[model samples]
Target: MAASLAAPAPAKGAWLETWLAAAPAASGELALVQQRGREALRQQPIPSSRNEDWRFTDLALLQTLPLTAASPAPAALPEVASGALRLNWNGSSDPLVDQALPAGLQQLSADEIAQGLGHTLAAAGCEQHWPVELNHAAAEHVLALRVTSRSQVSLELVSAAGAGLQALRLLLLLEEKAELDLSQLIEAQGSGLHSLVIEAHLARGARLSHGLVALGQADAALLAHVAMEQEPESEAQLSSVMSGWGLARLEPRAVQVDGAAHTTLRGLQVVDGQRIADTHSFVEFKGPEGQLDQLHKAVAAGQGRSVFNGAVRVPRAAQRTNAAQLSRNLLLSDRARIDTKPELEIVADDVKCAHGATVSSLQTDELFYLQSRGIDADQAAALLQRAFCEEVLRELPAAARSWCSLERLLEAAV
Candidate 1:
């Protein structure tokens, strides 16, 4: 392990001060946000084991990433499907340059960007989270757009960073009755920090299907927060797959602003070597008759660690809310560790909410059965891991599923 990445926490402000000092001067339309983020981070120290929410995750891995910017050096990416628009983001340049967007999809004007930015994050109650502040402090540009009412659009975003720090911010609005299919991919080639924050709002009757695939190396780290707000009659489906990071933390938050919306969340993470992966998800029902279904899975091998915490809330005003959350984990090594927590808080007598979690190793009987069919022991174990991950992988959009191969995921897990 790299000593810089494994070093225990540093004195209160030493690490962050160095990183902030090296960041480019705050400028552009987001100058205010950047300034505020810096101020917030300066006042708060890196979260440690004492903080309940970050108790199991370590931020020490962030100390050594180069303060200088890295160039884009993504691996060979998969081809996009026919009729889908693909945009490559280099973290410093505008991705929409020289490309024509399809009808019904347009970039938001400066005024619109100012008004819509951070709206969903506030609605999801994570606007001031530590990771979010970090993104706000560093990100200089945002890709903001709107899908016209009743229009259907397909979009893909790809980013690959070499080394150092890369920050990306995105905002999406689905107007009433509109539909959008969005697939995003983030990959890292060397030691660095990848920071991402996404906020989306679904108006009444709007629909959004999103898939995210993140891959990293043993010395890289990733911090991401995806927040969404849905109006009545709207629907949102989000699926994510992650693997191979020194440390990765993902936060997905959703809010049914006025109830009567449908939200489906699925996540799968694979950790091997000495890497760590953690996911925290929250969903709240603000009005009656809301519906939610969430499932999260993880695979841990070697001395890697996996952690998951899922929370669902149904207030008194959210009567008739229906929600279910489940966490499933696979432990591939005795030294590996897995922690799963699924929580539900319901104050509405008429609401139905349930949550559960399970952690276990590969099924001995299943492995034996596969080996009896002439499959080698290693192949049998790989097959079981693949089968276990397919449930969530299959939920990804077609293009994302094609880009994120099943074999690649299994190879990373075991």
Candidate 2:
């Protein structure tokens, strides 16, 4: 049986208080938000295995991480493409300083930021999540922007963490008929905690395509939340890939405010050694004619563990909704573990909803055929793994695809 999270033991209650007390005082544009987050943390217990959403995840790695803010250290980053805008964030300095933005993109005004900061999170129903709270408590600044109507833009945001807590926050608002392609890269250099929260609002006829690639070391942990709200005629495509984190939890939620929107989600995660990777995703259609297509894949080797829970909701008002979700996993070792659940709740009789999950290893016949064709056993296995991951990796934007590849992901898993 799982113990209560409120238990005063070392791993449950006391550690949170200690960590909060050690954190720096909040005083900035985000001061009130930070205070609220601290209060929420104090009121709630650290999420434990007792929580259904976190049942397969362990929070012990966070106790071993530094609780203070991370200092800005120089990073070695990839060069930017000729026509693309690139921003390097150290989790402290303003990436917009002395930079010029293209015609379609502009920094949000103070009033706009205040009004739109948490709207999508609230719409997606994840504003108070523990990871979001952690990000709110530590994040000092936000990168807020708006894409003007009928404008098209491409951007790349990169962050590399050192030894401490790194918090990243972003808010994006896309106007009617606007389009934006955003590629984000996060790399962990040493032992620490990296927390991130992103909220995006897509107006009517707007489109947003986002790709995220995260690579971490075994001593570090990551928590990330992405929430999106879509108006009718809008579209959202999100693809994420994560590898090599000691512990990682990613939650991506989307809501079609009045339905009639299109949403596509793709995710791939690879874990080796004793690492853990978990992804929980949710999508809801509130009105008629919404569509969703989602696929999640995981590869677990050694004694690693992988978990995925995907939920889709179609309410009574959401007639003519079409949604499908699939979870596929690969187990490479006897001790590796995988937990996958794809759930759909539909109250509308006219809606078509489907969900399924599959777990399997490399096909013996395929491996034999590869070995018979003169490929070594190890190389054959790697070929199969690469093929498995490419399905999702190919969905990334061109710029983001250049930042990570199957070879790099495979190497990181080791």
For every model shown, what is its TM-score relative to the native structure?
A: 0.96, 0.96
- Model 2 whole-model lDDT (C-alpha atoms): 0.91
Residue runs of model 2 more than 4 Å from their true location after superposition: 1-11, 73-77
Tens-digit lDDT track of model 1 for 1-414:
598788686676587898888777899978999999999998877788999999999887887777467678855767777778999986577899899999889999999999999989998888899999999998888999899999999999998888888889999999999999999988888889999999999999999999999988888899999999999999999999999888999999999999999999999999988889999999999999999999999999899999999999999999999899999999999999998989888899998888889999999999999999999999999889888999999999888888788777655444
How would you encode candidate 2's per-residue C-alpha lDDT over 1-414 as one tens digit per residue?
A: 356655555645666789888877998779899999999898877888999999999989998887677765554556787677998876566799999998899999889999998889999999999999888888899999899999999999988878888999999999999999999998888789999999999999999999999998898899999999999999999999999899999999999999999999999999999999999999999999999999999999999999999999999999999999999999999999999999898899998899999999999999999999999999999899989999999999888998888878877777
Displacement of the residue 76 alpha carbon in candidate 1, Å: 1.4
Candidate 1 residue-pair clash tally: 0
lDDT of 2 at 1: 32
Question: Worst ten-residue run, lDDT, model 1?
Answer: 405-414
